[model samples]
Target: MPRNQWKPFQSITVQWISLLLVCLVALPVANASEPKATDIVVRAKSKDAKFIGSSMGGAMVRIRDAESGEILAEGLTEGSTGNTDLIMQQPHRRHQSIAEGAAAFRTSLMLSEPVFVTVEVLAPYIKKQARVAAQTQVWLVPGKHLDGEGLVVEIPGLVVDVLSPQTHRYTQMADAPFPIRANVVMMCGCPISEGGLWDGSQMEVAALVKKDGRDFATIPLALEDVNTFGGELQPDGPGLYQLLVYAYDPRTGNTGVDQVSFIVR
Candidate 1:
């Protein structure tokens, strides 16, 4: 074959391949990436459980595949780093520009289809490595970002010291619900009424009951005052109980966890 005759054929083949590549790149995440799914995002918010306030930072979040237990993504909710999550940035540019979750966390992951996802959050309330923690499972749809249910964690640097009944190894009436009280401020530095990014009223407070150093149950405590909450432990029978008072500000993703020990006799 003459050189000129072969040139046209070669040019056509190259052009066809270039178009094919562009098409592939333009395809949705599912068809473009392996497993044939879309990219999704997970977000977090912190609220004060003790003072009904909010914290500015100090939260560690983890997203995992419920079935495989694979860690999909993880990050801190410290407001220092702007939330770079595609979900938070998506649907519009203004939303990303003015988004106010300084203590919030956002993580992106890819999936092929709809599946269950588990989100684990740890918020250090007292800087003692003890954290206000919460876990929830959410159904994530392909190509969609899912906002996890709010997780209540302890506010860093805040402690809800149990006041009513001194925490001790002594036993209480097993059949009776023991009274509980604590003094706490959920805000990171200032009071909730300061009227700034760190507010307390937006936080949710929940109580956790653990058995032998393991979580056994949760009781949501009611705020009595600015920084006080009242709740009770009604043990079924005589046993050791570890009660953790927790605060989480979903707005900033800050958390606080406090605990006292008691015995049921």
Candidate 2:
């Protein structure tokens, strides 16, 4: 192993190693510039699953750095029509309900590097306190897409259990007792009553029965328990009846409205 003999072999090996290193580093940079985007679809609804839609009609989605809390990308989950930011933009109309607006929110986000981040959903414009803020952690890979779990924000609103009618389309006889079972909660999913965070004195639940596009009768609901409320509806006559149940927490001025269309024999 003479020093002169080693020099020639070492030079060739050094050149081979440098070429290998260059290829490895250049590969990632070339792929990075092409820019792969991740499509994040957000869906919002009430915690009970009885209803699907935000009172605000749409929600805001923000992608933030999980560690630093810095927002990276932002977009909206609006009505069937795109860019429906606020509920007011597309007011409620016949056949077009609030649920139509809060159906799905879609956005594509692109990042230079893959990192751990948080997806934050906010429905602040919801006046009825029908929804709460939602956040979830997800791994954002630069070249792939990620789906999120269903984000539920309970509105301090009313949910009625139609025990008698079985189906929203089913008809109840005028003589049969249409017993109503309902649950009342705060926007944050806290049960409310006379002495809770939302004063029971100001809380009330009522069903507005509409016939022929006019107000027919208003049946008051009695609170059976903290979160349980019920009422019996004896329709004056048999026909097509529209029922609108309203739950209100006067303390915070949060209200929720639920509707049902049923036939009365």
Worst 10 residues of 2 by lDDT: 80-89
lDDT of 1 at 40: 39
Cα lDDT tens digits, model 1, 38-143, are 4433333323222112343455678788999998888766553233343233454542332334345555566666778788866542344345566788877656
TM-score of each: 0.39, 0.44
> Each prediction's Cα lDDT score?
0.58, 0.60
Q: Each model's RMSD to truth, in Å?
A: 11.5, 14.3
For all candidates, the clash counts are: 23, 7
Compute the lDDT of residue 13 as modeled in candidate 2: 100
Q: In model 2, what is the error at residue 115, expressed in angstroms?
A: 2.6
Question: Which candidate gets the maximum lDDT versus the true structure?
Answer: 2
Q: Which regions of candidate 2 are displaced past 4 Å?
A: 1-13, 25-35, 49-56, 80-102, 124-131, 147-265
Candidate 2 lDDT at 75 equals 66
Per-residue C-alpha lDDT of model 2 across residues 1-265, encoded as one tens digit per residue: 8899999999999999999999999998888876678776665543322223343455567778999999877765554322223332445565443443345566677766778988776653343324456787878777676544333333334333333333356565745678765666543233456665444456678888887577888988877777767788777777777777777755545567666767776
